[model samples]
Target: MSGNKIVAIIIVGLVHLLVGYALVTGLAYSATKKIIERVTTVDIDEPEPEKTEEPPPPPPDEAPPPPIVAPPPPININVAPPPVTVVDRPPPPAPVIPIARPAPPAPPAPPPAVSKARGVEPKGQSRWAARIQENYPARAVRSGTEGTVGVSVTVGPDGKVAACRVSSSSGSDVLDEAACDGMQRYARFDPALDDAGNPTSASWSTRIVYKLN
Candidate 1:
């Protein structure tokens, strides 16, 4: 190639390098300007306004009532009492009249009655009398129950217990029945004596008290 063409080529290459360098420098300067803008920003604080205080209200117009109090008692008086008259009293009244005590009421009157019929009171002592005593029934003795039975007996002319019955119940049926049985088998008496002193049949009620000592 010709010398002038080679020179022209070299000049063109130098011109393009110069243009690239200038463009890169311009971009870097723009980026630097943006960073400076972001870093330089500062925020300022504003002052607060002063507060005002409110005052208390004034007192009421009316006044309160006074406390109650009692008045003093009237001054004590010093007056004198009226005079008393004195007359002689008769020598202390004649000794009080003696009171007469009425005679004690008559003793209670004797009740009206007729004399009892005479029947033989059996000779109190007898061999059979002891046997008639209540024998505690087996069941009654075990149960701790005891009582008295009243018996009316009939004595034959022969002076033996002819019959007997329980005139009054001994609370326990066992005791009452036993009493009758005992009397019939064991009770015998000497014929009772009459006003004439003769033997005769008679009945007597006897109570056998059964108790454990």
Candidate 2:
């Protein structure tokens, strides 16, 4: 019986040893597998931090503007002239000594009138203007030009107007010529008488007035 017991105890001890050895060997194998896997894979890289940039400086300042000014006005000038000068001179000399002279001789005088009858003219106051109006020139009448003319006339011994002359102008040559021509052509006279009562030639002066009314 004791031998049986001892053998049984040895069998138990052997079983225990076997169990502890199996446990330790399993743990060591798991640790060595993890280390091998970590070593084998490559390490992952992280991205670099992002870079920051600064802003540009501000622009420079500008200069100020200039001031304005106005111009001046012009001036006027006046000048006076100098005065004139007067000069003196000596007086003139007197006249020379007088020289006497005689006067001119007197002209001859007409003889004294013989004792006789004096000269006489015709007896009536004449209406001679009627003759001038009746024969007035057509041109003068139409033009309405009026004037007065003085004529010297010669009356023949037959009591007629022998000649007529215009002594003064009537302001027109045409009017003056017409007056002398009319007198010579149409005028008549009763003639004059000398101291012996005989017909004689005489000179007479007359005037004719031409008027519209």
- C-alpha local distance difference test of each model: 0.77, 0.76
lDDT of 1: 0.77
Candidate 2: tens digits of C-alpha lDDT, residues 1-213 = 699999999999999999988989988999989999988876889999888776777776666666666666755556566887765965677878888787878877988866444332433325555676566767877998888999888888887778888887788777888888877766777777787767888887878877767
TM-score of 1: 0.39
Clashes of each: 0, 0
Residue 108 error, candidate 1, Å: 47
Error of 2 at 9 (Å): 99
Report the lDDT tens digits of candidate 1 across residue range 9-90: 9999999999999999999999999999988876767888889787878878777788777888888688677897787874
Off by over 4 Å in 2: 1-125
Model 1, 73: alpha-carbon shift in Å?
A: 99
Q: Candidate 2 local accuracy as lDDT?
A: 0.76
Question: What TM-score against the true fold does each predicted structure earn?
Answer: 0.39, 0.41
